[model samples]
Target: MHPSTPTITAQPSRPPPPPSPDKPPQTFLDLITSVLSLLLVSSLTVRSFIGRWQVIRTKLTSLQSSLSLLSDSPHWSQNPLLHTLLPSLLSTLQRLQSLSHQCTLSSFPGGKLLFQSDLDIASSSLSNHLHDLDLLLKSGVLHQSNAIVLSHPGPSSDKEELAFFVRDLFTRLQIGGVEFKKKALDSLIQILNDDEKSASLVAEEGSVGCLISLLDSHNERSIQEQAVLAVSILASGSDEARKTVFEEGGLGPLLRILDTGSMLLKEKAAIAIEVITAEPENGWAISAYGGVSLLIEACRSGSEATQTYAVGAIRNVAVVEDIKMALAEEGAVPVLVHLLVSGASAAQEKAAHCMAILASSGEYFRMLIIQEKGLQRLMDVIQSMPSSDTIEHVMRAISSLSVSDSTARILSSSTLFITRLSEFTKEGSLILQQISVSLLASLSISDGNKRAISGCVASLVKLMEVPKPAGIQEAATAALVSLLTVRSNRKELVRDEKSVMKLVQMLDPKRELVSKRFPVMVVVAVLTGGSGECRKRLLDAGAYQHLQRLEEMEVAGAKKAVQRLAGNKLKNIFSRTWRE
Candidate 1:
């Protein structure tokens, strides 16, 4: 029967085979990438939305709530919130509005009214009202803007709280809105009309124009102090802000501050000016605005801090040729020399740094110093300055000069320079010693100065014999390497096996970490930085032997150092150096 029915058998239809296995995995990867992209987009959108919304929400909440409270009170026209809730209100908005309105018509010595037993009832009532307002602002419930506007008119009384309130309010207004900012300006105008609260609130958030207005306030002392603060804040904010500060009478204000303000104010002002001159773009403005004269005046001021800041500012400005010429025209060189001679350690250090910056382009600064007979002055400071900070600054300046042919000529003329340099190698501070070593090394690189630099080789080697800071040791090693690399100085730098051995001792694994230790890799770099002749001397002096023996003995530390020195390129150096 099956054979007979075979012709009638039917074929079954089958569903198509499932997609390839690789296709599923590829789809999953695509989906993951799409999801990550979507997530990133969502996060960026959310952050932007939040930032814009926060500002709008803060303003809306402040305006709506205050306006509502004002409308709700029946006594709005009579006592107002200032009289009714002044004592109890904790909102900064209410306190600020009340204080600002009150100060517009009333007179307070600084912005406060002192309490007295025999005071009128009105005065007592006002005092109570102010006390309430003060409490409210102090609660941090109000925007900083409102608080600043309230204190802008200076003080209503000579009370200490008034001064404190003004200072605090200024700090808060740094983030306030345009209207509150206007109030701040108005408050500054009022304060300038008085002697108390003369300090202008020119923090980073405020306008430079606001600070300049203080100069017209007739209160010279207040104008001077506030101008300094404002300028400093502007200089710290942005390059555009610095430009605005200058355009809005920053130069005169800075000069006036240096002339009249306290030592602290003068110091801050000089720092601000220096910051302004730090950029190449601002060079012209600084030179044109008579910055050099002002800086020189400050450098010659009685205050050591003022001199320090002034010298630093001058140095930064002198980076430009025109600025340096202006400083020279203003007789800054004499003032700098005088500072290097008789000033405090900080002052002398700054003066040296200034001289270096000015002398960097040519022998301008060096010639000026030498012409003023300043070598003795520098020598004295190097010998007597107690702080290592000053020595560091001076050494950097001198080293920078050593790289210049013109300044080298000036240095070569002074016998005291060589003598002092030798002494510096022997007994200088860690930083000073390093800088001196680098200076000598750089000097020896040139044929003309080789003899002068050679004179200090022995002393530099001797200094390496004692226990030293890692930075000093590293610098000495680098200097010696540089000296030996040069054909002229090589023999002199590593003349003795003891000299090589001293460097080897620096490689000792037991070198403990100081509070601020040099990187061990840095020592290695210095050791190997020299040319074939010098590197051979160093290795022969047992430097390579010491490292190899330490690698075998101090396995962990040696591994670390090796790994560090190798970095990403270490593999290549390893294959080359350790090949069988």
Candidate 2:
């Protein structure tokens, strides 16, 4: 084994070519190549780190400059700061645009939604800038509305500041001229078609009458429809404002809308008609303009709400006798009577009130009532329901009959008139009692009926003496006026200073209400009818000062009768005594 190992060792010995010393440790080229590889790698790493550092420094500098500019220029749009930073700001925007483009290229789902959200958030900052710029511009710190508009521009404003800017710009331009009016009307017309906008805000910005005028204009039908809705709002509020809406041809369009319009437009038009026709002037206008026939047609339509509104309009229009007769001639009474008998409580009330107004027009409505036998039905309602308003209606019907030849003849020929008249004195509500007393005074026109009503004279005397509510007192004063209208009744009933003095007390402005037409007229008559003793009592009650006020009122009243008959009119009747 030893001999074999020696031989193997001897064979292997080539000394492994001892390390190369004389060869200079392998050529310098190899060493150089290794060193160069390491050096190149290190240099690459340092260069990459320096590039990253430069990028970071640039971003930080841009951020600092932007903040500095924002602080230096509060109103960047109006001031010199915008120009100063324009280049940098534009560069930043370009960079952002490039970045956004790259982000879009990634094509991530919801990425666009995220972008818009960010844009919205960014708009708030822009809004601040816009508002600041606007204040500067408005305060004369800056000039040019167009400049502000250009600074903050869009079809729609995303920023509140931009909104203010847009609003100011629009206001200035819209108020400038007819050209502006057309522009504004066109813009509003477009906005009204937008589903996302607040309708009320758009409507308020559009003038009501302007919108109303559009109905007749060559403007698009869509624009006219919007205008009709705007006027409906104007008509629904205060008296003066409603008057303006009516005077502005608002009624014409509404009636037209009633004839040809969508359900919504028709509804809005009906509401406008209701408001306009609620007052006497507007009501008369509606009738004068042939609105009554259209309203009647609308009432007959299938739409329940339309019918209700139409009823209200009709009721308001019926206040005038000619209008009432016009409605009657158009066969509106039966329709109204049907509504009263078969409709909801509101419709019924409206119908009843309308019937009362129609009935109050004397002979104009008496034939209709007598022919329809509406008297018994009305009396039934008054006796059973006993509402104050219903009572007023019943009395008005009776009052109408008092002036009606056919009705009066029927009442006098039959015991029915006397019987009903007597019961009015016996069993009636306060207002009903007042009405009955008034009817008795009217019925007392006949010598025979005078004796029948004479029993209630003491009662009337007691009613006059006692303190009463204003409405009752007014009713009593009206009854007295009616009774005193007849010279025969005035001479017989106003016999003593006691009665005259009592009437003089009613002439006291403080004690008696003079606002109502009926009571004011009655007081005028009573003072005119009083004797010497009556005039003295009137003076004691300070009637002279009240008469002076009436003379000053000069409200086309019988001044001479009040002065000559009541003893105050003569004191200052057309004299300069009170003028100074």
Candidate 3:
């Protein structure tokens, strides 16, 4: 290598005399601008040195590039991160100027004598600034923002413009001050609430980690409220957004807000919790962080909306089986029972659902609910006619308990419940009918409950007649089949020719998409226990041909009916035919 460059650079490349303050900087921006000028002057003044000095000049130019981009923004005055960064950057540049001067005056070569450490310090500071610059660039958040750029996609859209604006606000959220974060979050809420597309834009940016930080205890109440509100909006709108919030360690602060935040803030936090826990994979997170206990408290004392959302959140999280039992153990039951008795219509509905989940986790939980009189409270709410939704929730709770004989007895023994079930099957929505039929199916397992379900028999057959809602049709058949163990139910079932014909006609193999298993089961139930004339009515309605086709279709419950209807003489022929 040459001992020196072929030519000396500009005089600005050499170290200049030390800066003397002429006048105080009018503002922070002015101060940073003065320091930057000094750095450029000294960087060029060091033109006398080569190698290491060249490297420092390169870093100084980079720091200047990054900060200048930030300061170029029309709204630069409002950026707190820039305000904070400028002072540190100014100090770093001033130190570099001093270091350059020392290197120049040094008696030894390259400032190698006593100032080597200080030179290293100056180089390290420049490297730090370079690192900060890299972060600012990679954040995909330009401090110089809201100036529309060409969208990566072919055509520019206002939609794309809105997305660019959201990216800038997210940067503010990430590094802006308390008030900045608050304002950023407020704007985000407005944008997100305006439409779902705005929400998707923010979620695609994937930096919701700032939301968790804003939920920190030290933030002002207004800031925390806006932070959680933003979370609630994002969480409810997009799956990616929800996962982002969870991935960023947001659940801990969210649960903390739920525990200690003000009424409005708590409500916002609860909304986020309710939505996040809806994903079954995320259910365990609540109990993992002991949020379930906090939710239980919310159920006890949260506002109507809060109580409603909190109960929904608890219900959602209790889907994890281990957590299900843990939720009950955490005292969710009694509060749930209290909600069922006196909470608002919506809260009661959610509480009933949560109760059902907790009760169904184990026999121990069922017994615990019984101890709390939760079963009766559900029946009480069902009788109160709170809302169709509430009725369905209560019915679901009762049905969950009816899985066991002891609980089934408690449910079946309620005359009001049995009567309501009959009414629901006749007049309720498809969902209610399905639930009602399911309850009756479980209840009919006990002979005592069988007689009680006789009033529902007319409605069950009516339900089976409509083949559109196949779920209700299937459930109705199962319930009717279970009720067939009783003599009166079997008689009443065969008495309706229109109803019996509907069941037999559905067994035809031509209805390929229709599920024939449950319908066949119901037919077999009646044939086994009905009077001779009832069997004659089924045969007259063309049961033989349908059963033959269904048996060939390999429909379960069809073969037994084939043998029974074929009797002994034809049984051999039918069996041969079946084998062939």
lDDT of each: 0.53, 0.54, 0.74
For each candidate in turn, give its C-alpha RMSD to the true structure in angstroms: 29.2, 23.6, 10.1
Candidate 3 structure, TM-score to reference: 0.70
- Comparison by TM-score, 1 against 2, better one: 1
TM-score: which candidate is best? Answer: 3
Q: Is candidate 1 or candidate 3 better by TM-score?
A: 3
TM-score of each: 0.45, 0.42, 0.70
Per-residue alpha-carbon lDDT of candidate 2 for residues 411-430, written as tens digits (9 for 90 to 100): 55534455455556545556
Among these predicted structures, which one has the highest lDDT?
3
* CA lDDT for candidate 2: 0.54
TM-score winner, 2 or 3: 3
lDDT of 3 by residue, 297-374 (tens): 998888888898999988887788778777767888898899888888778888887777776667888888889988
